[model samples]
Target chain A: MELGLVHYLILVAILFCIGILGLIISRNIVKILISIEILLNAVNINFAAFANFGDLDEAKGQVFAIFIMAIAAAEIALGLAILIACYNNRHSIDIEDYTSLKS
Target chain B: MEVLQFLFFGMFALVIVISALGAIFCRNIIHSIVSLVITFLSVSGIFILLNADFLAISQIIIYAVGITILLVFSLMFTTTKDDNKLWLAFAPRTILAFVVAGTLFILLMFNITNKFTDFNINPKSFITKAPKESTIELLKKQGTTPIIGKQLLTKYVLPFEILSILLLGVIIGAAVIAKKDTNEKNRASESA
Candidate 1:
């Protein structure tokens, strides 16, 4: 068999699913954040691959990927700050500690 | 050329998957972060293989350098306890998560393989763009960075500007939220 877009898609799917798994099972808020990053990276790979293989007039997918990276950076910064505040209040970063927010 | 492409793809794929798994399952948080760094690097390699030189460079600079540094700094700042086990194996949702993830993976694999069969005849035309000539030939004519720049300024100018404002807001908001206000601290201590 020849290598094609499907191979890249398959890889992205695996990464995305594992990211979900990580998000589900990790108690540490930081680990959950990392899992979210993994999910974003998987989407980025999909965008980049589409732009790479497709014969578009412009690299629209790559541009989308760039935007995604910027947004992800901003998200991480804000999220970490929130985590810091949470830590200061509760003295722990575990998601389990925040039971009030669950409902 | 085909053999070389296959070899490079295989190597990068292996490196990305292994390190990504390591990042997720490592016993130590610091080790997990290190593995994530490696995974990010290998992902950049995959971007390079896709012929997205500008994207690959941005991936390295944005993800490997900027984001990783932020993660490490946050990891250091927030948590002082040296607890190694991060996984919630006993959590009630853990089994549900596994089942959902496993089913999703299988569904994706089946659909993708089916689509691959249908797309095999002319994989290039499966998505969009007929490409009268050839994709690689066209990509070779114009540099990726300049094209991306032109597109950003012309077609995507609004989003480009919006991103700047969003970034500015995020920076200031994060600073304000993370700061220890005297009033809040006093109230918090009084309540405690």
Candidate 2:
């Protein structure tokens, strides 16, 4: 069957749900970062689909997605660096174990 | 009726889903990074489908090539190679995640169904327009990077400047966090 707009939206929905599940369930910090990427991709899918079906302002959505990717790159860089420092001091990368920053 | 479009869409969806799954489920951090690269590429395909070829190429270059390599390099330095089981305890929280995500999905479906019922399905006409030659051709017609450069320098100058400041802050923060604390510990030892 030919995929319609609804199909695309449904796919995005499922992907968003999966991303949320991964983010909440995964204890690995790197996995959490990956899940966040999945979530961002879901948002990008929605933006592109709406732009395609309803608006000629597709370029705007694409532009915003590019910004998001840039921000994500910055976040991953800073986050992984912090994780490395934490690992050096604590000898582990487990989020549960990083309780010195908690509270 | 269009075979190529159908095939492209199928392939895009398949690659996106598989790569996303691999990114989530992979035990190795490096493998997860690789899967993320694939996911970025698939999203670029979706951008192409939306007639944003410039965005597609930028996405491939920035995400797949630039960011992924940075991630791999940082991971190599930080994490141990042999110790693969890096996950923390996660049993109790997973159930909560499922419940929340399921409820959100149901709510989304309800909203979409209601909205779609009220709206008549009108196939947008602009998408049927003949595809332009390429982004390069359009850029050539419009005098390429000058327009973007002008806009960035004028209209978006504040955000542009702020972005550079943000990058500088990140670099400083990363340096501070990643710095060895041996000197401080030695001071403490001497005092003790």
Candidate 3:
């Protein structure tokens, strides 16, 4: 069968669903971060598929994906740093452990 | 050529799905991270199939290599033992989460597959019949990197500058938080 836009859409849909599953099901905070990355990639696939097959003149989707990557990087860096500090204080990285705000 | 295209798409889809599953479903943190690496690499492969050359390489460099390494380094600092089964706690919450996620996915797929025939409802672009080969070549000639350059400088200049400022703040905040002072926190981290 010839490949069409729908094929790409279906693939993206599956990946997005999987990402959502990971986001919800995973216990580890790091795993949650990875799931968020998966979710972002799914959106990126949607953008690129549209940019390529959609009638747009410019690849705006690719540009947006790049911006998403930059934001994700910054967010992850900040998150990891905060996690380290949390671990330093509580001596644990598990999400269920830390229940304090003033620490 | 069409067959080759189908083959490529199928292969990429398979890789993406399997690796993504491994990344999420794996018991070990290291295994999950490794699976994430494979998932990213295959995503770059799909980008190449879509003729997004710059995106393909950037995805490889930034995601597959850079982010994965950063995550691994962070993992090294924490001492979550592999022998501990505490991470896999099964509860009523897990079941509830799965039910919610499944319902959401089903709803989205039904709406998407049934209602939208063609996503691109852009009237102007829809009016003209641009041949596929020519458009691909046009994208190549116009070049994605330059258009991105133009957009970042012109239309998105404000957000771009603000993001840089935001990133600077993140770096400084992270440094202050992670910095080793001659204190109990540092001592705890050092001994842990």
Candidate 4:
């Protein structure tokens, strides 16, 4: 079958759903961050695909994808820092253990 | 040529899906990060297939190497032996996650396949002017880096500067948050 815009969209949608599933169901803090990265990647793929098929002249979608990658990097940095801080305080990476605010 | 492209796409897509699943479901946290690296690499491969060479390279650099290393170091500091069994949650949220993900997937597929027929039928109609054949050939040959650089410095310079500022703030914030509490340590030493 010839590849089309729909093929890329389908792939992205599937990845996005997997990201969402991992984000919600994982009990580890690192796993949750990985899921968030996966979700950002799905969006990046969509942007690149649209740039290829729709707006080849200016390539704005590709530019946006680059921006998103930068933001994801920043996010991961801060997230890991927070994870390390929380780990130092609680001495646990399990999401269930950090429920001090649950009362 | 087209057949080879399709084959590569199939391979990359399969790897992305499988490794992404493994990234989340692996019992070992280290194993999960390894799977995540594989996923990021294959996603970059997908970007290459989409003719985004620059983004693909940065994806490998920023994600496959940079982010993976950050995750691994944090894992080293935070992980315990008990973490192996705590990979997946068994509470009520697991069921909710399944329901939500499944519903979103179905909704997206529904819209993509049925509601947006014109997008697949003829993507060119969405754009006012078709890119010249020569420009397409040039882009295919030289890649999108030049165009991306030009646009970044010209049209998107504001966001570019803002992103640099954001990165600076993140660097400082992360250091402050992760740094050892010197005051507490000093007090403990004095008391001892």
Residue B3 of candidate 2: its Cα lDDT?
A: 67
Note the Cα lDDT for every prediction shown: 0.82, 0.71, 0.77, 0.89
Per-residue C-alpha lDDT of model 1 across residues B1-192, encoded as one tens digit per residue: 767876887888888888878877887788888888888888888888777888888888998899889889888888765556555756578898899889989888767667445545224434644334555576678657887899899999999999999999999999998887789879989999
Write model 2 residue lDDT over B1-192, tens digit each, in one string. Answer: 556776887788888888887887788878888888888898888877765566677778877887777677767766776546764346678778889889888877666556445322222422322324574465456532343456557766787788778888988998889888889889989999
lDDT tens digits, residue span A1-103, model 2: 5545665676688788878877887777777777887887788777666655554322445445556666777787787788788778787666777787667
Q: How much is the lDDT of residue B74 in candidate 4?
A: 85
Clashing pairs in 2: none
Interface RMSD of 3: 3.3
Q: How many angstroms is residue B185 displaced in model 3 relative to the true structure, after the best TM-score fit? A: 5.4
Error of 4 at A82 (Å): 0.5
Off by over 4 Å in 1: B115-125, B128-142, B186-192
List the candidates ranked by lDDT, beginning with the highest. Answer: 4, 1, 3, 2
TM-score of the A-chain for all models: 0.93, 0.85, 0.87, 0.98
DockQ of 4: 0.70
| TM-score, candidate number 3 | 0.86
Candidate 4 chain A, which ten residues in sequence have the lowest lDDT sum? A1-10
* Model 2 bad stretches (over 4 Å): A1-4, A101-103, B1-3, B81-83, B87-89, B115-155, B185-192
**lDDT assessment of candidate 3:** 0.77
Order of models, best TM-score first: 4, 1, 3, 2
Which residue runs of candidate 3 sit more than 4 Å off their true CA positions?
Answer: A101-103, B82-87, B115-134, B140-143, B181-192
